[model samples]
Target: MFRILAIAALLSLPATAYAEKLANKLLGAKEVASQQAPMPIGSYAKGCGAGLVELPETGPSWQAMRLSRNRNWGHPEMINFLVDLSQTAQRLGWAGLYVGDISQPRGGPMTSGHASHQIGLDADIWQLPPKRVNLSRAEREKLSSIPVRSADQKSVTRNWTRTHHELMKAAALDPRVDRIFVAAAVKIEMCKTAKSSDKKWLQKIRPIQGHDSHFHVRLKCPAGARLCQTQKPSVNELSKGGDGCDDTLMWWVTDYLNPPKPTKKPKEPAKRTRHPREYTMADLPKQCLDVLASP
Candidate 1:
C-alpha cells in the first residue's frame, strides 16, 4: 500500500508541472488587430505570428497512441485562434466554445495528419457538446447546424453550425483569426454580405477546401514559440468571387461513396461464312481419302 501511494504521489507531481507550463504558454498569448469591423478571413494575423500557444512538454509516455483520419489539430496558430474565438463567444453572451483536441503528440500514429499535428500546438474544435455538457442527440445535431456569420457579416453557415450568425460574427470580430475553412456555398454568401469596410477585412482571408463534416479554424503562431510550424497557403488558395469557391462535390459522392462506372469492352468482329463449293471432292485431294475412311 505504501509503495502504491508513493508511486501515485510521484506521478501526480509531473502532471501538475505539465499543466502549469501549458497555462503559462496560453495565458501570455496575443492576437493581431483588424481595423475593419467585419474583418476578412486573412485580415487577422496569419501563418505563424498570431500568438498561438502549444501543449507543454511533459516528457514521454508508454501508452499506445491511436490514429484516425479527420481527427487532427492543425498547429499552434490554431490555439491562439481559438482563444480569440472563445473570448469572442463569451463577449457575445454565448457560452464559450469547446476546443475538442489540440497538439496530437503521437502525430497520427493513431490518427491522420500526424505530420501536421506533430508540433505541440495544433488542435481540433468540434460542435459535439463537451462530454460534461451531456447534450442530447437532437440537441447536438441542432448545435452542429447552427448558422454563424463569417467575418464579413454575411450569412455564411459552416458545414457544422453551432448557434446564430451573431455568434460567428462576434468571433470574426477578433484579430487573431488567420483564415477559416468553410463550405463553398458559405464562402459565397459571406462575400455577398461583405460591406465596404468589411471588404477590406474580407479580402485578406483565403478560403480553401474543407468538409461540412467539421469546421476547421487555423491561426498564426504567437511570438517566441519555436515549435510552431508554418503552413504555406496552397497555390489553389483563392478568395471570394473567383469561380465561386470552385467546389467539386461530384468526386466526394461518386469516387468515395458511389460505385465506379463500368468500362465498356470492344465487340469482336463476326467470322464470315463461306458458301459450300460444288467441287469439294477435287479441293479435298488426298485428305478426301482420310475423310471417306472415317465415314
Candidate 2:
C-alpha cells in the first residue's frame, strides 16, 4: 500500500515541471549553427530555427543592444530585413536604429521575457533611435528606451513624435514585415495624425500591451521554409483591410484602461500552486534537439 501511494503522488506532479527541466538543458546551451540546412520549424511562438545567423553588433545604420544576452540571432532573411529597415529609417531622417532582442541561439521558449520570438522572425526595435553606431556593450546595457505612452495609458505622451509615426509607417509598408505591435495609445495617435495615403499601411500596425518602450516586428514565413508554421487567421486579418481604429481601439481606452470597481469586497485570490507552462523538447519540433546539439 505504501509503495503504491508514493507512486501515485509522484504521477500527480504537473507535467510542466518535467518539461521545464528538459527545457533548461537546451536553453543553457550557447548559440551554434546546426549541421542541417537553414530552416525555420513550427510557428513563431512555438518553434525553433535550424541554421541561425548572428546580427553584427553594430552596423552602419543600427546598433544591437543587450550584448550579454546573446540574443542577436535570427534567420538570414530576418537579418537582411532588419539591415534594410535600419537604412530606410535613417534615410527617412530618423537617427540610426537601436535594435533589441532577436532570438536565442537555438530558438525556443526563453528563460524570461516574451512568449513569441521563438522562430527568429520576430524582433524588438527600441523606441529611442540610436544616438551613435559605435555604442560599447556597457553603454547598450545602460541606455534606456523612452516610453511613448502617457501615465494613464489612455493617450500618447509628450515624448511621442511625428518621427515615431514615420518610423512605424516605414516598417509597416515594408513587404517583409507581416505585422508590427505597438501600444494602443500609439495606434490612436497614428489614426488621428496619419495622412490619407499613409493610413493604408496602418492596418499592419497592431495594438498590444507593454510596447511603450519598443515595437515588435514579425515577418511572414520565409520562402523554402517548408516546416514553418503560420498563425491561425485572426477573425479580422489586418493585412487584408480594416484600419483597426474602430470599436476595438476604443475598448483599449475605455474598458481596458478603467474597469468598474467591484460591487463587493473580493475574496483573496488563491495562491498559484501549479508551475507556469514552459516549453520543453516535446513542445518544439523534433529537429530542434538536433539544432541544439549541432556545432
Candidate 3:
C-alpha cells in the first residue's frame, strides 16, 4: 500500500511543480538547451524546442544582433539556413547579413517582443544589409535596422533597393523556407519590381505588420520532426498559387490598423485571443514539461 501511494505522488510531481508557474518565466530562465536529440516539439507559435544549437555570435558572413537576449539558439536546420543565407547576401552586393532574434536556448514562450517564435524554426533577419559583419557586442545593440517601408506604410522607402529585392527572392526560393514575412508595403514593392517570369518564388513572401525593419523567416517543420505541427494552408495559398500582391494592401492594412466592428454582439462572449505570456505548462504541449525538466 505504501509503495502504491509513493508511485501516485511521483506521478503527480510534475503537475504540482509546473501547472501554476508561467511557462514564459520557466522557459525564459533557461540559459542552455535541453540535453536531447534535436527536435522542434510543437507549432510555431505554441511550442518549444529541445536540443537547440546556438548560432555563433559572430560568423564570417553574419553577426547576430542583440546578444544580451541570448536568443541566438535554434534547431540545427535553422543555424545552417542562416549561414547559407548570409553567404547568399554577399553575392547580392552586401558584406553579409545582420541576423536578429532566432530563439531562446530552450525555445518556448518568450517573456516579451513576440507572440510567435516559440518554436526554433522562426527567425528575424534585419533588412539592413550589413556594411560589416564584425560589430562589437555594444555596437550591435546600439545599431538599428533601417526601415524599408514608409511611415504611412503605403510604400517602400529609398532604402528599399535591388539588393533587398534579390535577397528576399533568394530566401523565398529556398526549399527549407515555408514563408517569409515583411511589411505590407515591402510586399507591394516586391510585387511591382519583380520580373513577370520571376513571380513563382514571390508566393512565399507573406505580409504582416511591424516587419518594416526586419523580415521574419519561418521554416517548415524539419523533415521527420513528427511532433512539430505544420501550419494549415490559407485559402489563398491553396487556390491562387500567385504572388500575394493583389489585395495585400486592403486585406492587411485596413483590417489590421482599423478592424471592422462586429455587426452585433452574440449571446456568448467572444473567445479572447490567447497570448503566450499568460501560458503555463498546462497550456503547452505535454512534452514541453519534459523539455523543461531535462538537464
Candidate 4:
C-alpha cells in the first residue's frame, strides 16, 4: 500500500537525499508559488503543491484576514472555490467572508499550525460572517471569529444562525468539496433540524473537534493530479450513501466530550507519533524534491 511504502521510505532514504533540512523550513521559506504546471504532489497531510496561486488579499465579496501570516495562497481551484463561496456568503445575508489561512505560497508542512493544509486543498473559513468586507489591514488583524458552539460543547450558541446552516449546506452541495469540518455540537444541531428526506448533503459536513470558530473545507483532488491521494471518509455509513446523522455522529457528544475512565492501563506505552512539522524532504513523496527545487 502507498502508506506502507511511504513509511518504508522514511527509514531508508538515499544517501544523496538523507539529512536534507526540514521540509517545513525549506518549503515554508518560499514566498511565492513554483513555475511548474499545477499539480498536487501527495496526500493532504504529506504533500507539496505545484503552481499554487494567491487568493487576492481583498475581493468584492471576501477579505483574506491576518495578512501578516501571508497564508492567502492556494491551488487555483481552491482560490476560485473560496471566491465563489464568498459570494454565496454574501447572498446568505452576511456582508461577505473574512477568509482565513489557505496555504503557504508553495504548499508543504507549515512551521506552525495545521498539519493538513500542506496540500493547498484544505482551508479554514471563519465562523464570524463579515460585518463588512472592506476592513483595513489593522481592523482585520483585531477581528476574531465568533464561537458558534456552546461553552458546554453540547449545543450551538446564539451566534449560530440560520445563515450559517445554509452557508454550510451550500458548500456541502458543491461537487468539488470533499468534506467540511465543523465542531461536533454544531453538526449535532444541524442534524437535529435536517429533514430525513433531504439530508444527503449533510454527509460531507464532518464533525471534528475545536472548530467552534471556523469550518475547514477540504477539496477533492483535481482531475489529472496523478500523484494525489484519495482519502476515504471516516464513517462507514457515509460510504454507503447514508446521511451521517446516526449513532456514530452522536458519539462525539456523548463519549468524546465525556470519555469514560480507563478501566485498565496498557502495559506498553503507546508509540509517539511524529508531527508533520518534523517531516524532512526524504519523508515526503519522492517528487517533492523536484517541487522544492523548481523555480
lDDT of all the models against the reference?
0.35, 0.79, 0.88, 0.86
Worst lDDT 10-window in candidate 4: 2-11
Q: TM per model?
A: 0.41, 0.85, 0.90, 0.91
TM-score of 4: 0.91
Angstrom error at residue 170, model 2 = 1.1
TM-score of 2: 0.85
lDDT by residue (tens digit), candidate 1, 1-295: 5534643543355654633332112211211211111111111111111212332211111001112222222344554456566556555554555444443222211222322222223344443323233344344334432333343322343533434234445444556544455544445555555453544343323344442333455444445544344456544344433222233233323443364875878568788652221112222222211211220
Q: Positional deviation of 9 in candidate 3, in angstroms?
A: 9.2
**Which residue pairs does candidate 3 place in steric collision?**
none
TM-score of 3: 0.90
In angstroms, give how far residue 55 of model 3 lies from its true place: 0.3
Tally clashes: model 4. 0
Q: Cα RMSD (Å) per model?
A: 26.1, 7.0, 3.9, 5.1
lDDT per residue, candidate 2, 83-141, as tens digits? 99898888877668899999887777776778788888999999886667888899999
Q: What is candidate 3's lDDT per residue for 73-170, written digit by digit as tens?
A: 99999999999999999987899999999999989999998988887999999988898989999999899999998898888999999999989899
lDDT of 4 at 155: 86
The candidate that achieves the highest TM-score relative to the unseen native structure: 4
Runs in model 4 deviating more than 4 A are 1-20, 237-239, 264-267
